[model samples]
Target: MLVSLARVASESGWVRPIVDGSDVLEIAGGRHPVVEKALAASGEGPFVPNDLSLDGQRRLLILTGPNMAGKSTAMRQAALITVLAQAGSFVPAARARIGVVDRLFTRVGAADDLARGQSTFMVEMAECARILNQATPRSLLVLDEVGRGTSTFDGLALAWAIAEQIHDVVTARTLFATHYHELCDLAAEKPRALNLTMSVSEVDGRVVFLRKIVPGAASRSYGIQVARLAGLPDAVLRRAREILANLEAQEPADHRHKQLPLFEAHKSAVEEALGQLDLSRMTPLEALNWLADQQKKLR
Candidate 1:
């Protein structure tokens, strides 16, 4: 087994990762070893190499990208590299610096354990509970599409809460890949949260997956294009497009508003006060008075 490991490492041009004691992770030009081997056997184009970095200030990566854009592959490779390094094997990367992880947790794919009488969402939540309860500051977690088995609002809410708990309480290094673009908001408020997405481009109205990780969130999921690629009937696809448009049109322009209770009543006075406030020109005293007035109105 050792010989085979060494041989594959040499053949694949894998590198010995630096086992640093610091709470940091750095990988440069990382590629999925299995995918690389498959491409090599088929004489296809080389895999695209992408870089990843996480540290004390930026420990959680919220990865958002379109379906079939290699989000899962990239996240899995990170965990795999850690496994290889701890097992005394070279990793598939140009360079790597890995910290010692006490525990490795992954919630990647959906599977129901029928014998246990648990549904897919039940299994997902069970695993998630374990991760939340067991993972520590030195643990590594790769969670892909948590809370995806439920309604959109419920799923988004659960995803948001899980992310916050991991960031604020567990402080574990995590690679979270999701179709929920709204989760990207965590990066704005949390110092240790960062956003990443797989690069994609359009060529003559067709979607192309670049399979390269880049900074920032993806603008859209491109689900319709993926369904089209899956050979869905033209009529069905057209209907789906229309329904998607109508749903999106009903969504609030601000993602934050979506979190508000669906039946919450809007206050015209509060709205008017917000619109009338000119923060740039207001003095501190004036600002205080305005806030007091608004507070009184609410009462």
Candidate 2:
């Protein structure tokens, strides 16, 4: 394995990363060796290189982009480079400087523990819990799609809380790739968190994956475009587009409600309903009926 790795490093022009004891990681012109080799074998043009820099002040990256836009590839490459550097091997980058990590944790991809009767989300949460509990300030963590197996609200909530914990509590050097764009808000709240996204462009109404990492969050996931590329039936694609448009149209109202506190927003109505309740004179059956009426109003 060492000999083959050396051969690949030499043939592909990989560089020797500078391993240090400080809390900093910097990579310039980094490429995934496997992907580069595959592209060379297939003559599919040169791979795009991206630069990453992190330190004690910015220890966590919240990466968001459309599916298959190289988010996962870039994140994996960073982790691989870190591991190679710590192992005293050359990494696939023009330049790299990585701090020594006490532990490396990766929560990527999805699978079920069928033999143990666990669902996909259960497996995902189990791995997530392990990382949260074990990761420390000196650990390196790469998490992709951390809460994707659950409902949108639940997934976003989980992803948000996890990002906060990793940033505020664990303080690990992390690369988090996720489809939940709302998680990008962490960059604004946490000094140690930053946002990154894979670059994409459009030409003649078709999406093009630039495969380049850039600062800032992606505005949309472009799932329909990806579905179209995957050759989904035209009828289904059309229906999806329509549904997407309606959902987007409703987003403003949804966002407004999301911004409000649930209890505070409903306080006036609750007070009014309570004012109508004659609790002192009400019978047990009357109280039950009033409770049922209030519950129906809530729904």
Candidate 3:
């Protein structure tokens, strides 16, 4: 796996390695070295390098960044340096010094094993479980977008718990990438943890990624920019804006209030509507009023 990481990093041109203690990882670089290289070959500049260091003081580093801002690339480059160093080959970085690791675990890039009849979420959980069960103090664990397979609250809860375990229980050198900004509070409380993020800029109402890693927390993820970059239809983009407004206006998931399932609420309304249907007993005028009331209720 480390070899694979190195090959990808070598091709990308921007994956530079940094050594702080016994750990070896790339500084600010792309996520998948292979993919980054391909883009560079087509004349795109590589992402800006961010600050990544491993001092024995902090074993777990939390990476926070907007989508497509190079969090994954940074993760991949770190893994690649490990592979290159172990193979006794020159790495793609300016420098590197590696700590010995019994095993390197990555929970990035998960998909369903359909041939095995497993759900994507199940596969994700399985990978996470593997990390939690096997990681040791000397291990290097990279987890990307954990708990995205479930509801927001469930995912956040799982991410928070997993981070806590990785820090307090496994005590491994970890790089955790997440959209859950709320988890930054853990860094405030834990001495062995730190928060870092990719950089972004705004120009003429457009956002550009600086790709630099800096010490701090991410403010927001421009999901709309990512969607537009993916070539979403204009109408879809407009509707998405509407949906985002509604989502944002809703209560935050971290709040104590319980959430109701939309599908279950819809089903309950259907059942109630069915029970209200009594054609035999209703006069025409009364039936019209009842229908109108039901329509209002549905709305």
Candidate 4:
């Protein structure tokens, strides 16, 4: 547990107290202590230098950026720094002024716990609930990918509500990282709540992560490029693009929205048509054209 705690400390940096109405968790230039140390023993250039700080007027920091852009690492590093500083050790950062937190809670990512038979998402909610129930004003909570198990609206609703609860009710310092860029709007009302983002660059169709943290939410998540990076097949990528296009054209999910019923009706019509099709009488080429025409009509 100590080893794990130390690693967490190295990955997350410190959360300093609010000074002059500006709350900033100061992080001076430092490599990922654990990650860099290992790479150095094998002789490699270290990660870049960066600084980040948040004030009381900004009690919460929402992080956004493309996958593998070091958003997760930076979030973890900030949290880790807070833990180490509170534990009375010299932080991995060159300088930091962390508020004294009574407890440090984190829900970083969902992973299968086969022994417990819980789905990855279920485990995520369970950890979040623990933080909500137990965290105090002096606590520091780090959450990553909250509400990832469910549909878009469901996930966004849950994430929004949880952040509100932590800020309005629990009043704990929070670092929330999510793919839902929409949540950045919360900063408008929650002055104590702010958005932070990681930097990214493209070179020869490849992504390079700057690993630096800056103020404000990101505008894009670049899911397709990340999917390509994961080795998604060409056909699958094409299909994903089509689905994304359709979703973008669709209305937002809300109780007042009537588009969902329209979509369902369209799906039902397609199913009926398929059921009634004379497959034995049609040529393969004819069948393919028929399906394509049907799909086009839905759009």
Q: Write the per-residue lDDT of candidate 1 for residues 36-145, one digit (tens) a residue.
A: 78888899777888889988988899999999999988988888898998898999999999988898999978899999899999999999999999999999999999
The number of the candidate with the highest lDDT is 1
Off by over 4 Å in 4: 1-24, 38-45, 202-206, 251-299
List the candidate numbers ranked by TM-score, top first: 1, 2, 3, 4
- In candidate 2, the residue pairs with backbone N, CA or C atoms under 3 Å apart (3 or more residues apart, or in different chains) clash, namely none
| Model 1 poorest ten-residue lDDT run | 260-269
lDDT of candidate 4 over 19-61, digit per residue (tens) = 2222345666634566656756788666665676655666788
Q: How high is the CA lDDT of each candidate model?
A: 0.89, 0.88, 0.75, 0.74
Question: Any runs in candidate 2 off by more than 4 Å, and if so which?
Answer: 259-299
Per-model TM values vs. the true structure: 0.87, 0.85, 0.75, 0.71
- The residue pairs that clash in candidate 1, if any, are none
Q: lDDT score, residue 254, model 4?
A: 45
Report per-prediction Cα RMSD to one decimal: 4.4, 10.5, 15.4, 15.2
Which wins on TM-score, candidate 2 or candidate 4? Answer: 2
Name the regions of candidate 3 deviating beyond 4 angstroms.
Answer: 1-36, 252-299
TM-score, structure 1 vs. true: 0.87
lDDT of 1: 0.89
Model 2, 1-299: lDDT tens digits are 88987987898898999999999989999998889889889999888988988899989999999987999889889988998888888999999999888999999888999899999999999999999999989999999999899888778778888888898899999999998887787786678899999999989877899999999999888899999999999999999999999989999999758745422323466668887888999999998998888889889
lDDT, residue 261, model 1: 59
